[model samples]
Target: MGLIHLPTELILLILPPLSESDLAHLLRVHWSLYDIILPYLYRRHLQGSRDSTGNGRNEAKGFFRCIVTSNTAGVQRFLDFGADVNAVISAAEIRKANFRSTGFIPWHDTQTPLNIAASMGDDTLVSLLLNHGASVTGSRNHQDARRAVQPAAVDALLSNHESTLRLLLRRASPLSAPNMERGGLLNCAIARGNLPLLRMLVNEFGADLNATWQEGVYPLNRAVVSSGPEAAEIVRFMLDKGADAALANGGSSNSNGDEESTGGGSQRLLDQAIRHGTIDTLRLILGRGVVDPAIQPLDTGNNIFRTWIIERCTPETVHLLHEHGYFRALDSSQDDTLMIAVRARRGDILQLFINSGVVVDLNARLTRGGSTLLHAAVVRCKPVREAQAASSIRCTTMPSPVASSDVPTVRKIEPEYSREVLSRRCMSEKVEKCAPEEIVRCLVRGGADVNTKDARGISPLDLAEKGPEVVYRILVDSRCE
Candidate 1:
C-alpha cells in the first residue's frame, strides 16, 4: 500500500469520485474497514440468497459500490497487517458530548455503518463486526485516541446490537430526556414499525416510553399515522411508563423541541392521513385520547378539526367527534362552521352537522353578516342551482329530510336570515360564484323576500346583474310575496 501523505489521502478520496473504480475504495481508507466492510457486503449479498451464487459475482459487483469492500483474501491480509477494529476520535467525542447536550452523537444525523448494513439487508457484515469486537455502542468510536460514550451513541450501539439491543433497558435514564432523536432509538424502531424492535427498545434497552422526537412527536404519534393498532400500543407503553395522559399530538414548545413552520411536518402528517381518507388511522389515533387538539399553529390558523374538514374527514368521523364533544367548542353563539360550510356550498356536510345537533340558522353566518346558506353560496360565487341545493346530505338519505312524518309544527324562518347566511358564506367559502336565480330561489325557499335589500339597496335580485337578465326575471316570477 503506497499511500503516504494526508494530502495523498485527500487526493485518494477525490480520486474515487474521479476514477472509474467503485466509490467504496475511498471508505476502505479507514484501516478499521480492512476486514469488516468486505465480508459484511458479501455476507449481506448472500445472507438469504440461494446456492451456487458464490463469492465471485457479489465480490466483483461490490467492488463497484460507493463504499467498496474488498475480496476476503484482501480483507484478511489487511487485518493480518494489524488494523484497529475500533478507532475512536476521542477529541471529537469529548467536544461534541461536552459542548452540546449529554446525549449528543458525533454523527447524529448520518446513519452508522451498521445501520447502513442493516438497511441494505447485509446480515453477514453485521455479524462479522459483532464478532470482531467492533464498538457496538455509539455512532462512531473515534477516541482522539481516547474514550467516552454519550447517550446518543449508546442508543445507536444498542439499536444495532442484536442481543444487547433489548437487554440494555436497565441502563436507560428516567430523566424523560431521550438521546439524539428526541425519542431516541425507540421512535426510530416505532417509525420503522417493528413491533419486536420496539419491544426490545422498551422492555430491554430502557427507552423512555414518553420520550418525544424530532419535534415534540412521541412514539404513539408515529404509530398512529400508520394504519395498524400495533403502533398505538407504543403510546400505551408510555402510559404504562408513567407518562401523563397528555404529552403531545398538537402544540409544542421550542425548548422541548425545534420551532416548526406554521402547519409544519407534524401538521402535515396528520393532514396527509386525513387527506388520503384513512379513517382507520384517524380513529385509532383519536381513540387513544392523549393528543392535544388546541395546539393550532398560530400562523396558519388551520386547527386540527378544520384540517380534517378540509381533508374531508368522513361524516361518520365528524359525528363521532360531535358525539364525543369535539365540535361543542365550534357550536358557539354564532356557529361559524355552518356559515363556512354554507359558503362552500357543502350542504351535505352542513346538514350532517345540523343532524348532529349543530345549531343551523337558515342564516347562520360568521360575524361578516352572511345570510342564508344560499346567500353564502351565492357570495362564494358558486353555481346558483348546484350550490343552493339543500337536503343534499347522503348519510341519512332515508330519513335525511327529517320531515315530522311529512312536515314540522310549521315554524317559518325569515328569508332575511337566509340572505345573511348566504352573505356569511360568501365571506368564508371558496367555491365557484352563483347565478342570480339560483340564489333567489334558495332564499325564497328559506323564506327571503325577493325585493328586500340591505341599507345599500342591493337585494339578491339586484345582485343578479352579474348574470343574464332571465335570471332576474325568473327570480321575479318566483318571488315571495
Candidate 2:
C-alpha cells in the first residue's frame, strides 16, 4: 500500500522521521495526508518536540513558512493552535532552514514574521498577524535590532503594494511616528512614482509636505529626479499642494559637497534636473520661479554660468536657462563664462554666449594660472585618437548575409565599415592639430591676448606649435609671436 493509503496514526509516526521538505512534498500528494501532516508540523512546535537530532532547529520554520508562502489557512491554523504570532527569524536560523529566499526579507538581520508578510504584500497574512496581536510597531524582542512596522510599510511601498501599505497605515500611527517624521513612507512612494499612493498619503493621511524623505531629500526634490510618466505629474501635484520649492533640507548625508552646497532641496533639484532629468521636469521646476537659477552654489566655484557648462548641458537647455533670466544674473557674478566655454571645447556655446548680448572678457585669466580664452581654446583640443575612437563607436556594424543567395550585389553590399573608417579618418584629421580652428579664429578676432603666457609660461602660440598646423598658423598670423 502507498503511504497515502496508510493509517493516520502510522503516518503521524512516519512524519517525525521525515524532513520538512519531505512533509511538504507528501502534503501535496494527497489531501488526507496534507491534513495529517500540516497539523502535525504546527503541533510539534507547540508541543516543544525537538527533531531527532535533539535540537529545536525547526522551531519557528512552520510559522514563517505560512507567512512567506501566503498560506493563509496554514497561518490561521498555526496561530489558532496558540503559535507565537510575533515569532522572530534570525539570519542564522533562516540560513540553516530550507526556506525560499524571496530576497525581500532582510536575510542578514533578525525580522519578525510580520515583516516578511508585509514586505511580500500579503494583505491576508498581514491582517491575520495584526489581528492575532502582531505589533504593527514591530516587536523589540531583539532589542535595537528589531525590524517591524515602519520598515514593513516602507518595504510594501517599495514592492509597489498599494493595498498592503494602506492596510498597514490603518493599524500603525504612520504620520506621527518618529520613523515617519522624515517622510520615509511618502518618499518611498515618490521614489516609486506611485501617484495614487502619494495622493492617499497626503490627502487622507496628511503626511508632511516639506518633510525630508531622507537627509537632504525632500518630497519635491525626490519627485523631480524620479523617472516615468508619473514623475512629472507628481512634481506638479506637490507644488500645487504648497510644497516649498526653495526649502533646503539638512545637507546630504555623505561628503558630496555639491549636494551640501545646493542645500539638497530645490537648488539640487534644479541642478540635477538640468543635468539628467527630462525636459518636462526641468520646465516644471523653472515654471514655479521659486528656485533662483542665478544663485551659484558654493560647489560650482561660486560661478553661476559654470553650473550648466561644466555639467555639459545641451545648448537648448542653456537657451531655456537664458530665457528664464539665468544668464541675466551673470552680470553681477564674476564667472568667466567665455573661458569656461572655450575650455569645454563648446564653440557653439561660445557663439551663443556672444549672441545672447552677454559681455565676455576675452582676456580674462582663469585664476592666477594665467590661462586665457586663447590658451583654453588650443590646450583643450580633442585628441585625434579620441575623436577617431568616438567616431568608430558611433558607427554601427554591418549585418552578415544569411545565405549565398541572400548576399547583396556589389552596389548593395557597400560595407558600412568602409564608411565608418572614412568618417573616423575625417574626424581624426579635424581634431589632429588642436581645438577647432573656428574657436581659435573667434578668440583671435575677439582680441584675446594670444601672446599672454599661462602660469606654465606657455603662450597660445607655443601651445599650438604641436597641434593642427592650421591652429599654429592662425596664432602666427594673429601676430601672437
Per-residue lDDT of 1-481 in model 1, one digit per residue for the tens? 4433344445434432333234257446776544444444444433322226432211221211211231334433333333333322232322333422322233333333333233333345444444555444443244232233333333333334444442223333222333333335655555544566666656655666655656656555565544333434554555566643334445444676753344432443344344432354455445664432444221134544564372244455555546545565333353456555555445445556655544544443334443444444444443445444633643563556644562222112111234333322101234333443444445455544555454454555666555445555656666634
Q: Runs in model 1 with CA error above 4 Å?
A: 1-77, 86-117, 120-124, 139-183, 213-217, 221-243, 249-278, 291-317, 329-332, 344-348, 355-357, 364-370, 382-462, 465-481
Model 2 steric clash pairs: 433-467, 433-468, 434-468
Per model, state how many residue pairs clash.
Answer: 44, 3
- Native-to-model Cα distance after best TM-score fit, residue 105 in candidate 1, in Å: 22
Native-referenced Cα lDDT, model 2:
0.65
Tell me, by lDDT, which candidate is best: 2
> Residue 84 of candidate 2: its Cα lDDT?
69
- Model 2 over residues 358-382: C-alpha lDDT tens digits? 6556666766687777887887654
**lDDT, each prediction:** 0.43, 0.65
Number of clashing residue pairs, candidate 2: 3
